[model samples]
Target chain A: MSSFEVPEVSNKQVIFKNYVVGKVNDSDLEIRTSQLRLELPEDGTNDVLVKNLYLSPDPYMRSRMKEDYTSYVPPFTPGKPIDGYGVSKVVLSKNPAFKEGDYVTSFTRWEEYSVIPGGNGLKVIDTSESVPLSYYVGCLGMPGFTAYVGLYEILKPKQGETIYVSAASGAVGQLVGQLAKLAGLYVVGSAGSQQKIDLLKEKLGYDVAFNYKQETDYNAALKKYCPKGIDMYFENVGGKMLEAVLDNMNKFGRIAVCGLISQYEKENSDGIHNLSRLISARITMRGFLQADHANLQPEFLQKMLGYLKEKKFVYIEDIDEGLESAVGAFVKLLSGGNVGKQILKVATD
Target chain B: MSSFEVPEVSNKQVIFKNYVVGKVNDSDLEIRTSQLRLELPEDGTNDVLVKNLYLSPDPYMRSRMKEDYTSYVPPFTPGKPIDGYGVSKVVLSKNPAFKEGDYVTSFTRWEEYSVIPGGNGLKVIDTSESVPLSYYVGCLGMPGFTAYVGLYEILKPKQGETIYVSAASGAVGQLVGQLAKLAGLYVVGSAGSQQKIDLLKEKLGYDVAFNYKQETDYNAALKKYCPKGIDMYFENVGGKMLEAVLDNMNKFGRIAVCGLISQYEKENSDGIHNLSRLISARITMRGFLQADHANLQPEFLQKMLGYLKEKKFVYIEDIDEGLESAVGAFVKLLSGGNVGKQILKVATD
Candidate 1:
């Protein structure tokens, strides 16, 4: 325990300035610097002091910035460091399960240093894998598992069946398209830009990709792509897209409601018109949380690692330089400025 | 094979004049009398000529009036007698399985006589039960099975859980509330009129009932009734009611979409705005057809009959006098004028 000396450093944090209303901007959060000791306090016998290397900037983080919204996760407090999924190195640990130099992933703060309580949500990652440590905050993390659950467990993709994914170039959507492809499905993805559409088609191996911003009629676009009708829809951007998807869904179709990023920012939601199609088609639409499916995490991680090794799954990350850039990165993410999983590189390995 | 001789009769039929665009009216159908031989033709070896007694006018019939709407059942053609759940007496049969004077229920037309193809959807009722023959067309038939499948198979209500049923005094809604009450659930129902509300609370055993038309804010009304959030929603009238229910739903709530009567007549559906709540609450919304759950029919019948015999479950019917009243009955049923399962008595047994 006394092998090395612990150093005190200035901890940089991305703080939530206030509860955001309507569209989230960089001004919603502020950067603050504070002092932190590398060693645990005398009473912190079950805590691990970690230096955050990479922090995930997710669309769901925008949801947490609001004060009174009811969701699976609680809202972030103002004047405090915002918390999210981050990959970190255990610099000093009083917990028996964790030691110094152990690489782990947890719901840590958007800060350079964090003292995470042991055996709560902290998961030690396998450093033996040649994948980047930041992968734990993106592909090997919550977003990856969300896609797996939505595809295999919710929609249950069948071979030769058609699948349509909204926001398909994003973290979950990209993986969902790839997984549907691996299951021998006719996969089509919709994104906001030409670059994301290209990434979805060329890089992600989607059968068809469309820039939704360019399509005047979403229903016409979906009909053009899914000629046979959509058997499964991985719904990310809801509202008008969901309405169009409902119109193009086949009999006994399934919609896995992963996210509604399109509706999150708006004070009044863009209402869905064709929900009656759900009855005529006998569709099943279910919403789920990744935390609820923790039992499948080991299997998810194993299969994802294997897919990565075989080059069957390709991952992309849009990384900002430091914790100071988190607010800008998150604001950009919400506006669809970045493709794939957006991450803020807090520190180097 | 029979002592009584068959006689030729005038088949009085309610003919669908043309496909209805919006709300159906009496002008959309016409009563026509056609001559028919009571005896089956020698070549009609697999057909049974039945004298229709009672015909059920359901909300789903509105969907069939559309020129090109896809459903589990085919659309009713113009100039043809509309088909529905009917109780009939087999008057002439070339098929050996069904004999003359045998009572059967099938998808029969709004006519005095129908020559249904044998062994195709015909189910002979047990007349020994001492229940009314018209019950086979309403409470003890297709509507009953629909409620059973939705409550037992789909929602699977837990004791003490809260349930909200829309279109409360109608065919399936009445049964769903009764079933939920039988399961010890705190049941609340929403109907369009005061009479239906009274029927729900006083007659149908719903713990609370509201006239949805009278309520300015449905969410507030639901919140007042179901202080504990809705655990299961038996959806009958969709559109605004569904949107309100979504807002008042508890986490892990289940919604069994039986029918969307509110949206059937509208050209453009009233869009649901609060669907994003489905994700936050982790709701499971499913749409089902009674045909898909044929295996549960026998069990449903046994339990329903038992409940009826014990006076544990009450049945209601808004019976119209003759086949001449068919168009009026159907029109009224769509507008929520009928209190219970609307039945058109085509003939007396």
Candidate 2:
């Protein structure tokens, strides 16, 4: 009935230039089209072709630009397409593990088409109408897991404990506050702007939200909010905020250091002096990466999906369309321009 | 046997004059004997008579000078003799659990004689030839337990991890270095003077030792020694050393804050601006008191006794004879003049 013309094999990929030094420019990235077909290459082993639909512009991606080693995580190799968390659909599979039409989450390059090994980089997602599929990158994914593990596992927040989170309206911070609220904690959060603070209070449901920019002195602000003292601090934005939090922490307080967007672009980072407060308060401060919480993924997804289904949870998504806007969106995410999870939409179909 | 009249029971005790403001003076303390008898009150239920033998002159006693609520441990009541770890011989016990002629340790006041609750204070020490009796207050006591938990549990040091201990010749710092070395770690220590640095290197067996007093720039000194960056930092003298350590720490570096002796005397402590490094470095910095590590006591004693029996551990004591000299010894400990664990001999007979 139909003699089909072979589909034009033009693969569009996002390429990274030589490592960015200071504030990352859009010119640091270029979208180039490759003549290679979207089909999986005829390598004899298990490789699959994926049509990337959603790409995550995470703050930690900035770490890949640095050359030095950071704990258990390795820096991404330059001169190649930088890869991060993305939602994709399997187009063709040389391996039997994934079928021709299955939704999956993978660490793939910023591209419309990619070929990756079947076993290592792919995780299958069971979809439902309860929430949007893009939520796999936010609430039910890495960011949500990061919030859960950092708050519950690291901080071990007890009921009625006072909790403070920086970057309150950011992807991770927003979820952290909600979870803290669910745990019956007295929660306060710091955001970059009044709009974000309002969003944190009205949309995300933080007990108290303060625009750090409006607050002249962080210590005074902490004293005002906490009054008695903070029992747990979810540290995301470092610098003066951390110093302030340290001074107001209760005895045996806990701090879970998740990120530091403030100094990610700076050459010489700011120093905090009041760390001695850790001893005086007998605080336990721990740093954790989300990958360490893989074991909690099942529990995280089950709980988050249940919340979404019950309409008890609200998540904000700052979606930037097309691969061309990925670089700009990523820069904005780092600069705290975006309120929530920054997701770049590659294609709808 | 020569007939001995029971020592005339003067019930008076030492009194602290005013709250210690700056460096404690010998004149700040005055010893006065009271007309109270050594015998416990006739109706006492849990009372015991303890003739004080050895009392510890610890650095934390200096915190009692301040009225700040930031204190993790409660401050000693002013105008009363300071209380800390002490070794004593029981003379009488109204409580049946303890009896006469038993050697015990208690948080007793800095005085020759003390009547304590048998149930409330004191742990009987089984006399063993493994170590000296005074070792109970030094090596096998608070300092030793502190080093054990902070280095092993809190830091969770990996073999070959680079560890830096401040106040390397102090009671806790000295043991931290030794235990770190035994754990197959690369240890570096910083002390205030050249003599202390030499002691850290030669007697304490630290891999690299520095005199913080001689070094103009602490950050430069840290970078020079820790080229690969520090993995664990044992904080004692917190202020500038903490700031410098933060700058040089590797990602996921752990800091166990045991004491902040340098800031204890200051009314308004100096601001350390380098604390934000914890987020960038992804450091896990915790503060602890040794009394909280009671669960690990058995393990600590076993390991410490093994080390002591093999002569793998060596302890130094700065012993001040008589109860009257106790106040001066405490002042020296806070001023960093004492070479090792400061001890006060009460009776010794």
Candidate 3:
């Protein structure tokens, strides 16, 4: 170890070359290791040097490139390192709460090293665990928070209500289904393939699961599975699916609009006509960002960990071993190619 | 009055012929005035016969006929008169709280007379001197309640927020826009015609107004009006309008799903595809029924009456003379022909 030059301390990052129209290809991103040092400058006031370990590749990235997406949090800069949720270790810190060797979870570029700023964006990850650290990038992290907030805060799951989640095998959807089930809800979910559908019912314990791709009529499928009608819909893949759900939702039904992977790829989308269902059924649909639910991390982690220990919750991860593979994995995840949380292992244990 | 052999009348009704579609024709209803020759019934028995004077023509009635609308409320039975919120004079009381001659509001049929049984659905209307008796069927009635519930209860209006209400000069929309303006919001509205648009800005006091039919592209119109992005969308028209609104919604914006008149007549409707915006924008979209907000009526009426008396609020009504004209006027109302509350003057004042 002493004989090594530390590779000149350069940084490796995944960058989006340009915005693609339809399905994103692997060639869209380039993994270039910079000649710049990975460590933060000694005089940098608020920045902290982070050694990235795990990175989450969510489906929402697909919608970021569209010219229509201007009003949202600015899209990933075309030539800059693509940023997302990740787990990292602080190698150096100028921020008061974070010190050298501290672990934190936040939005970080898909790179082996990064310099993050101080203030409200960063939080120290408490590790008194009987769990794997990578779980922080999946179940104990953003995806988990997505599920927790959707169920407790948005959906407001009541006992015995019929809950339906789309993309049931995805990281957030899987956790949401399980949480609804724990609350004594009759849960149903839809995934792209039969394999994913089976995973939802068999592994995730969803009361009913359907392959939405194979189901020619999404509304008919919803009617078949949700005989009494849906009390809540945890939306993931929007478009025809939402139209169908709107038609089938019961009175006072609550919908947590989480993700809509289906329409993100399309340049022009179709009009939504079933909105009258909102008036008739009196549904409450809300969209949320996980960052807003940071205050609930303690409660979410405590409950999720308890479920993990009792074997009540199961999480599956699709791993990409290198930064170069992150783009392909992310693209595939957007197209519903991955079974669960699409993860990139930037630095292995 | 002496020429007519007014037998000891018991009850009279206007029964519907059948479920009419498209535009309601005159043949749809028949007024059957009869005398049962029975004395006034007892109280606490749920039976109350009120001589109904005013009946509201709401757009939601169009949805009540569809076989698919069972998810909300049961369809109006064909033989029974179509019922909605009405201001009536209680001639005989069977419900304990409501006495004879009391002006009560209930889901009364479109008839000269109605017998309502107290199964938890009647409210005594204490007429406010500041407003007209007809207002109970308009501003101080269901429309006001709908606006109050949708804006304050569902939308949670914040100061200076931009709110866009469709059907701007219509019953619910007019009140909602005015209330939003009163709440310090920058309110815009979309109406059916230039006249309606004029009424929105000049009469209803909407900050900006557009005639949706004249705008070839809803999305473009939304962009033009809400350049900085809309903080809240009071959704009424669905189909293309909803799709367009989705594109212009700001992150964390709230959309109160009030109604969807655009798609009610279409056989095969367009599906909502832009719902994916919910994920990227972290928007909160919810729907509510006025029936659920019944509890707020007392307070709503109090405030609304004060506004009307003080001239802070002005409501317009498109009245059709006699029961004979009701069906046509209601049909016109459904076609977006009427500018405001479409009321049927069942009896002479």
Candidate 4:
């Protein structure tokens, strides 16, 4: 019945070499090639084959590199492709939900191709407009939803209130500032670089942005930038930054604990003092995972799509070309090497 | 026409000598006698003259001793009497809210008699329930209300969930343990000494109790006692104990930061590390004051009164006699010297 032989494909991949310790290095991951038949397995299993286009290089991934880390995501298997959120095109499908040529955002391996069982978590992308495919793995993906849920759902930003976003130029922080601004909040931000600070203040519509690395005292910087005091905090970088923010928060302030990117690679995470301020200020510090707020996805997509269509939202992605650049992009994302949302561009069209 | 000639009285008082810097001592306070005519001022300030009966000496008073401290209540004036909640009888009333010879709980200074302007914050005691007048300063006053609000409103414990309370034998903590127990929670507590530990487990109905002073590693102690992981925490003692509790909390756990007595007298508060767990565990840490939820007082009174009337609650007080002992009782309360609620019995009948 086969008119021609199915062509084999060379699947290039980024494989995690071992359980990482302390800070990660380029050597911890290796770019290699493996043979693939480009077909579903013979076993009676419902699965879909997808060719990955772009992969997100996120800071939260650092926690999963440890052998015995506590996180929602499990540790990466040694000698296996690193798994993460990515944009892909369904190459083949045995599941009724997905078909060939369907463009989707999915939990895919860090490889040219991945076989997703039951086509689970494959969200079909609405590529109706002129939006780039790479944005699906960055601004319109998990990172974007994280910003939405963390701000609107958790912190519940009110009009005329002030919100401080740390790591302001990063994936989640950038969008949080913009969303808070749209919601009529006085948005303030702190980033490591002058470039990101500029982006936050100018392009992202933050009321004020400061270079935290240049600022000798975070508390003083917060006071100078946010004169009225911070009413809400989107905490990304932790340790000393958290302590300072806690001191400056207004009465009944809320803190959305999204990520502690700065402390991820440290041998011992920084100690946060000044928690006595929590009682004095009646602060509510809540740590959250976007997966827990999956109920907000549909609304998040509609609102974010509207912002993009209206050109009201600025989605910045630092896309590294080729699959081989994934490790570098990931390392940059963790080390604040990238200027914006870090992503690895694996394919075009 | 005067019904009787007013008698001049010598008021024995404890006055704050100065703004205390380090740990408090007996020298920081002075017991002095001052003359009182027991008459309202001629300017008609609508004040009431109160005969002070029982005085509450609490850990929260330690913060007021500092010149630059931030609290809902302002710092103590150097030349004025130390103010606290106390049971008193209105000897003379110009304000219609209180009448002569009526027993009430009011914010009065640490003295035998106090002239309160406008009868502000005075709650008349029924004396019909047969509850002791001193109970108003201990179990039925701020500390009891503190435990009520912290457990029910902030922590919101669920049946069968585990609750860990620090400073478990102290004023607020003892009530929190008993109330949480009544709420069908698995209550684990930690105190400074073995006697307090016995009181917590044997009498207060805590499922388990440990001496934090004896436990070398607080985290280890929590793990051993709270085998199921802590879902709700009544955080009375902060610093290292808070650090340990944060690590032991379960996902989506809640911490009611009622008091941080351990850090109140310290020059520098302890640094809370492992806040990264706040994100991983998706915890909610809230610091609250019972005064903020003042509306709950009537209900707190009704429920607590029922608990007492039905002989369901045990209220213990380590009462030191007279105004002269106020300083020592207060210092003992701060140093964990008292077995239960620490209060000064200013006068009987």
Specify the highest-TM-score model's number: 4
Per-residue lDDT of candidate 1, residues A1-349 (tens digit): 3525666799999888999889987788899999886776667558888889999888888889888878878899999999989898888787888878889898899899998876357788888898999888777899999999999988988899999999898989889989899999999999999989889989998999898889959999999999999999999989888988988999999999999999889988897887778788999999988878899999999999999999998998888988888888999999999988888898897
What clash pairs does model 3 have?
Answer: A272-B272, B9-B35, B10-B35, B10-B36, B46-B117, B46-B118
Residue-level lDDT of model 1, residues B153-213, one tens digit each, is 8898889999999988999999999989989999999888888898898999999998888
Predicted complexes: DockQ each: 0.75, 0.41, 0.57, 0.81
Best by DockQ: 4
lDDT of 4: 0.89
| Poorest stretch of ten by lDDT in candidate 1 chain B | B1-10
Task: Evaluate model 3 with DockQ and give the value.
Answer: 0.57
lDDT at residue B204 of model 2 (Cα atoms): 89
Candidate 1 vs candidate 3: the lDDT winner is: 1
In order, the Cα lDDT scores of the candidates are 0.89, 0.82, 0.80, 0.89
TM-score of chain A of each: 0.96, 0.95, 0.93, 0.97
All candidates' TM-scores?
0.94, 0.81, 0.86, 0.96
lDDT of 3 by residue, B1-349 (tens): 3424434653456567776555566676666666653234444467777777888888888777665565446777877777887878887676678888787667888777777766246677766474566678788877788889999998898897899888888899999988888999989899989889888889898989898888969888988887778999888877778778878888788988888888776776667766767766778888777778778877987788778767887888898877667778777988898978888877653
Q: Per-residue CA lDDT of candidate 4, range B1-349, in tens?
A: 2425767899998999999877898999999999888678656688999999889998888889999878689999998899999999999999888899999999999999999988899989989999988899878999999999999999888899999998888888889989988999999999888889889888998999998788969989999999999999888888888878888889999988888888888887777778888899999999898889999999999999999999887987898998888888898988999989988888885
Candidate 3 accuracy as lDDT:
0.80
- For model 1, what is the error of residue B27's alpha carbon versus the real structure, in angstroms, after optimal superposition? 2.5
